[model samples]
Target chain A: METTTLIGQLPEVTAAGVAIKAILILAIISAIAGFGTYLERKVLAFMQRRLGPTHVGPYGLLQIAADGIKLFTKEDIVPQHANSLIFKVAPVITAATAFIALAGVPVFPDFTIPEFVPVLGGTFVPSIASDVNVGILFVIGMMAAGLYGPLLAGMAQANKWGIIGAARTAIQFLSYEVVTGLSLLAPIMLVGSLSLIDFNEAQSGGFTSWFIWQQPVAFVLFLIAGFAETNRTPFDLLEHEAEVISGYATEYSGMRWGMFFIGEYANMITISILAAVVFLGGYNDFGFIAGWIMILLKVAFFFFLMLWVRAAWPHVRPDQLMWLCWKVLMPIAVINVVVTGIVMMV
Target chain B: MENFLASLFTFQGFAFYLFSFLTIILFWITVMSNNVLYAMTSLASGMVLISGFFFILGADFLGVVQLIVYVGAVMALYSFAMMFFDATREIKEKNTNGAVVFVLGGLSALMLVLMFAAPIHSESIQALYPMHEGVGNAQDVGIVLFTKYLVPFEVAALMLLVAMIAGIILAGKKMDKSLTEMMDEDAGEDEILTQKDEK
Candidate 1:
């Protein structure tokens, strides 16, 4: 009878366990987002042959903390004519949605707490917060929903530049979302499952087993579309300061602005995680290393690649960005999907 | 208190109640908001909440599709609202439609109550495809969608294509006028140049 009761309590314990994991993931990921800004500045500076943020701490490690304090102490300003409520809520939406999407992502391998612990002992925590069988779709849907942040923020501020930025945000996000979906579809078809865990297991053998080998075109399309989705360089038209004066974020200040920044970096991390998990081998071990470590290495490489691309490339014109998405990348993605389907039949 | 909270959480009815509450509230917000943007936002929220119901009911594929379609793709409604109306200004709803609104609202509420009271557990009700234990929801939905509902699916796809064509044609009409005006101006300029050369 005691054993049965203990077994009955298993689901509750696991639920509590995952809830804890979700909180931990949120805290750690947001912190990493803060640290990522520092990494960006340092990496960009080095690429340009200059030192970046050397004074704050050793190699500017504490710069994120300094930036955090500054942002916290800074005056929270709301424009006189602005729709204050929506403007204020907008950044939170961006940040919150980004974190919420992280719930579906498997950041690390699953683990169980030791039985030596008190109340929550022997509870198993899955790598993902909620493994909701429709994992990829849920994550992508959440990310797509994140478009509202910039959309509402720009409109609420009532600035002309902000309006233009918001319009761009709408068009850009909507367009690339199609490509993102289409490019991912082929791989999803190949895997025959939408669950990220299944995708991970499909490529568990080695680098040779990665989807990038089977569906290189899809991989390339996804990467290009991802760059746009994350609002990264070469497609950063939404906030190209030269043209649109900071775009959707022109009027935002203080921690409100910091929230948008965090949202952006968090999105970057999500894209990287998706690419690693979907195209590259995800949480699967190399010859010598463990699965978790291998996953981390893959994630780190993708993160570094984003920074590198940002440093190396120049921003594209909005027209060019639109042309590429609609005229070029999209057609390629559709063909790739068709070819993949035909190949599968054979 | 702890037990109450635990019971509230662990009860299956709690999720249904929570999702239904959200769906009703957001639906009301969508209908009643004076601001077009707010109305559209709430509409999207309500749609998402509806998807939440699907998720809770174990129709994961349907839930995701609902989100991707209703929340994501159908945001054309939002863009139209933003473009056609001044979003910041409140729309003054005329009092002339008060009786119509009241009757409609009442009828909807009555219908909802009737729906709630209906015997969903009736013995005659049966699932088309019996649950194949261990098969994922997506595969099940795919099997049914492709095999049984293929005609309906194709019709839906055709409807979407027609909608796309209509949207393109509507947008193209606006561009045509400007292009013609520019062509006329160039033609007049060419006439003037030719006349000057003859002189």
Candidate 2:
């Protein structure tokens, strides 16, 4: 697995064997995804002045791990009325899409390790699955693949309520996805390259240098659309337990339910990283590791904000959801796009 | 060993095989299916399978655009029409008379031979095969579409408008009812236009 470094310096080391590298990346991401769930509940609990999970482990760190074991061991029951094939595949689809999403993300600068366990001092290489020049388009297309997950889950579950939930999901996805694409368009225009590294470098200067400053309208639209994309409360129509009883996830229980839940939080994490990259100067800070820390803080902040909004607001009506997107968010996003285009060109 | 298998079931080789299989299934249904709607759906499926082959060939934009435009839009519209016509098992075979069937069978044979017999040449559609191998930026696509492909792009747009107009006309008397209800729902600036048109 020996390869030349980007700087054409000394060859890097290999702590991890070649055969195990990609598998390790996938395993780590899956583990981290489960861990993120624990972080969300603990953080949310603390903000609410509760002890979170004193029973599970120290500060509830083992909650997600315990839950993970419980989920895997649970029975995957299929409803007699359901189209079992599509139902079974739906959760797996929802889960795997995020890892492919990692391909387009940059966890560390120039750190995509073709060979793991670096030859030199721990700088592996670029931290992406692919150094795709057209990374942004791939991300969007991947995002579309994500829409089928919930749609299939809802449809294949075969409840009348499930059909309604699926329809809501489809309509909701169509509407909010428009805003997400529109908002991202401004940044794409700003950076001109579809590469994440290129986008990262565009935000290099400092706090003042962030794209958020130059394109505040685009920034606001992105955050709002990001909220809807993750289906966090205020925007979470997909799983309102009180009304429609779990929306698209009505019939799912045990590990199947857990998969959907974790997939959701992982999607939130992915979008959090993306929003940080595009608008908030991803891993770029006032000083050294401060940039990376800044991104972490921003991500945690967005995660917390989602929790607060969840507790704070009620779900909107299905018709209202479509109207909000088509009438409100889409128009605002369109305006942001035009203004961003004019500003960039001028 | 790896190269041999890679060459044998080469990504392109498997993709082409899949495409041909689907195409055969589609044409078989196109002739034999009891429902016209199934034939149309099969046709769209076949087309999309071909587009997947296009991706294997590394014609990334062509593959995506083919799926987006044909499978997504064109086929969707065709399905809407088929739905409107109430596509059932009976009427799909409605037009497949002995004479018509013979003519279409002869045409299909001619098409199959022509397609296979065409001189095989390769400019390497494998341009974007390994994923992320295409000029993506939207800017590249924009430039090519607006500059070199401008005439065709404009022509496509004009053709779309014509098709839409034809669709509206063919869609019939119920269109007024649907349009007015939609107009009622969106009773804004367009209401005035609809009111004037109604008179």
Candidate 3:
């Protein structure tokens, strides 16, 4: 009777656990988004062989905090001619959507609320806010939702260039999304589970056990798609200052501009987490605390690499970006999916 | 039956209903939006909702595929096309048709009716249990795809190859005549002017 009582409540407990996990994950994502600025300022100095930002605090750790206060206390201004609703809503949406997408991810093996929760009756497995079982789909939806921030920002600005920039950004993001999807599909088939936790667990056994080894082609395609989807270097044709002049982010100021920055950083972090979870082993570095450490380092490394690429490479043509997705990434991804499926099956 | 009923009453189950409702609304918005970019957003939302439904069905692979492929790839395609074409030309690019819409509506209605009635006319309804086919694990999916489904897999590859060839031919032909020809024309004109001046 006791066993059945416990078993009966397992579903509810799990559900509550998921809910708690979702909140914690979102908070972590928010902190990372806020802290990443500090990390960048400090790191840029080492990379450029020059002192980046000093005097704010030791190594300018307080620089980001100081900047935050300045932006927050500064006068909030809206152009009299702007679309009030969308303009105001875009930035918050951008940041919120980016953070929302982080819910499906599992940071530590047991970190996502425990599988079950204890209740007076027994234990139950409640869903984290948006597990959706189709979590990959949710992530995609949320990421795509983030794009609206730029779209609306441009539209609200009512400037010709702003509109054009937004238009170009929309097309660029949509184009890359296909390659990202196809690239992600290869792994979905490999793990055979949509759950992020399932995918993470499958990637356990050290380097040899990683999915990247099993599916190198997919990994390459995913990286390329990730670059384009986020509007990073080589795929940063949307903003090509020589041409579009900052893409959809033109005319953004204060917190509004910060939203775009936050969104980009959030996406970068999310993708790095994905790279670690899907390809590199997440939270499984063979030692006690190593998994968490390794995942963090790996994510930071990839994100820094993205920044490095941003500083190093020049922009690509809009047409070239499209052709690369359809011609290069998409085709390769499809083939990889086929091959991976065939090999795994065999 | 009891477990199935339990799932329907549970929190996870309730969330599914919410996701489905949101998905349906977004899907319509996507279909209704005149702007291609807006349409893509809506479509992405719809796919997300469908992915949630897949989660309810316990098909983990299918759910992720829906998210990664639909959101990551298909939505991207829509956005890219919108960006390339300049989504501002919504008024000019009204290529939609009413006749096609009605036909699609009728066809979908027929499909819906057939699907709804499928269980009513068959023994399949009486034995409605989760089909825990051997196709649960990666290995299982692999074996089936390589062996039993080998021919279809090969066919997909062949189709992809044909598409590639067609794309190359089409792309090459278009570029050679227009941008390249125009570029060469100005150079040729400059050279002729220079030659005449020198003479």
Candidate 4:
């Protein structure tokens, strides 16, 4: 179908619906990000053969709430020599960009409110909020912008460790960004559209149609880039306590620190969703499973994989990280794109 | 009153005005701020708001590129460099050459006037590649860029490549020795010099 009409055929998303959807995303995702901390701890603990957060509530479920309370109630501290303004704004940038990137990501399938609903009865909410034509690029761009959070934070805080962290953030983020963009380019070439919805629709066919099967190299490259982009284990050199003392977050405390935590978890979720949608069959159904469930499972698996890798692998040195990005991942991604283009031509 | 408010506050118009207001304030800060870090931050934000104008104009692709290229890469690199300098200190510069400043300002104004006037003065200005109806904004831009402006695009890429290589050549002169190893060598020499003096 024509691209224009494809959008036109979708039910009109009223302003109220959009607003409601935005709020839903913000509330639910923030909650999920909080819950993710709990889940990560549990998963990591399980891997280490230990109990994690058992005192908070039954099976440590309400540990999220307890942690939230602690973060909220903790005193906000600013170091004496720190640049106060930028230091304060740094975590906000991180959290805001992570959430903003979600605006282009479709977390769940679109649905309309029932007529019985009071304010937004029969209102249609899109899966992807806004649904801009350049969804993939916009999402990637916002995530790229998120590097400022750690970069500014480390710079603002007047600590030698923080400065070192900031320098690492600059090099790591800048280098990985090229890998991320190049890795995604091959899948984008096959899809012929930048919109995530189009990517989903293109793979509506079954498991065989998944881009992961066709562009396995791109999928692996994207996953590696995603791990680095999200600052997960092995690449978590940005805040490795053993090296730079929490890196950019060395001086942050209380809610400001919590914001950074939330931002990191949100980014993890966003990268997981991107992986599921772009490479895996997205929200497309497998024979026995529903589409929504399939996507949720895919996202959960990727999220779990991040934690598993954290448990399994050792962090690379700063020089090694740079080498992997520039010398290895970047070259492979470029070659993958070239090969994909050639195959398409043939 | 309701009709007047409704007429005055279109979503697009409101967004444009808001972004414009923020952009102007940010640029003002970029120019007037004493601290280098503050000036850099404001400049980066101003660039982002400029991209907001592109989004408001329905150029989604351009807005995103502006964000990724300028705010993401360029400004981050600037901040990285700022880390080396004492960014906490206020920057002080003398404004002694008023005549040179005035001449440069006048030249820029004249250039801006010419830029605005050129479009109006042309008799039959037409889009070399008219936008296709069913295509998205990105695809339309890609089509025009590849087909109509291919030569200029390739030339620009080549120019950038030359500049990049030149930059590497200039920066990579001392690439053989690692910074840590050099520092260690200096420490070792200091220790040896102290031992020789004692002997």
Maximum-DockQ candidate: 4
Ordered from best to worst DockQ, the candidate numbers read 4, 1, 3, 2
- Looking at candidate 1, what is the lDDT of residue A129? 87
- Count clashes in each candidate, considering only residues at least 3 apart in sequence or on different chains: 0, 14, 38, 0
Of candidates 4 and 2, the better by DockQ: 4
Instruction: Name model 3 segments beyond 4 Å from true.
Output: A1-13, A70-93, A108-157, A167-171, A174-221, A240-242, A287-289, A319-346, B1-13, B20-24, B27-43, B72-130, B133-172, B176-199
Summarize candidate 3's per-residue lDDT along A248-319 as a digit string, tens digits. 666676777777778878888877877777887665665444565677788888988887876667778777
After aligning candidate 4 to the native by TM-score, how far in Å is the CA of B21 from where it should be?
Answer: 1.6
Output the number of the lDDT-best candidate. Answer: 4
Measured over all alpha carbons after superposition, the RMSD of each candidate to the real structure, in angstroms, is 6.0, 8.1, 7.4, 3.7
lDDT of 2 by residue, A196-265 (tens): 6677788888788899888788888877777777787767777777677877788887888777776777
Model 1 TM: 0.89
lDDT of 4 by residue, B147-168 (tens): 8899999999999999999998
Tell me the tens digit of each residue's lDDT in model 1 across A82-147. Answer: 778788888998898898888888876666778999987888776788888889999888888887
TM-score of each: 0.89, 0.74, 0.70, 0.92
DockQ for each numbered candidate: 0.45, 0.12, 0.20, 0.55
Please give, as one word, the docking class of candidate 4.
medium
Model 3, residue B174: displacement in angstroms? 2.7
lDDT computed for candidate 3: 0.69
Which runs of model 1 end up more than 4 angstroms from their true locations? A1-13, A115-121, B1-9, B94-103, B173-199
